[model samples]
Target: MAHFDSNFIMSRILLTDEPTQIGCVYLEAGGIIGFHQALSAQLLLVVHGPASVRCDSESEVCVSVGDAVFWEKGEWHETKTETGLMAIVIESEALNPTKYMPVKLIKD
Candidate 1:
């Protein structure tokens, strides 16, 4: 087990406004979240295992633990896993991940 020097660590606040929803999602093997438009800005953070994600007509991209995928409101997207996975999904009109995380550029 790892240990921290301090007994307590201060946490920085990110969002102040109430978000539409924040929830955990579990995708079973061979499961798929069908293609659909995002009603609000959405962020999906993979917490366990691996999965594939696609936005609009782009090619599907593989994502594993610690990967974060963001989709803007009204954008078409889909997610699926062949071996099951768990993720945290955050949806909000005020969501802005760029402010806190660096962008991951994908080479064509």
Candidate 2:
């Protein structure tokens, strides 16, 4: 519970035993993070701007602020943007977003 006047919110805890890393990435206009296989399970959370992401041979998907993309270990993926963007990336062998995040269904 949060106090009405506190302006503070608590987040659910995530536990991991394997090595974990978190990073903030910025992409300029026309920037791209080329395709590569994920070394571990990974999650990319967009915090600003918009970008496109692709996994394996799948078509690119546009993502904007507040969108999140996850990739399993060994999955090939790529990220790019035309108008720049900023995102938080989390990597770990033990990452499991399904435990804390609701699945977002996409129709082909």
Q: Please name the candidate that would achieve the greatest lDDT relative to the true structure.
A: 2
Alpha-carbon shift of residue 37 in model 1 (angstroms) = 0.4
Going through the candidates in the order shown, the clash numbers are 0, 0
- The per-prediction CA RMSD against the true structure, in angstroms, equals 3.4, 2.0
What local lDDT score does residue 14 receive in model 1, on the 0 to 100 scale?
Answer: 45
List candidate 2 segments past 4 Å from native.
Answer: 8-13, 105-107
Candidate 1, which segments miss by more than 4 Å at Cα? 1-4, 7-14
My TM-score estimates for the predictions, one after another, are: 0.85, 0.89
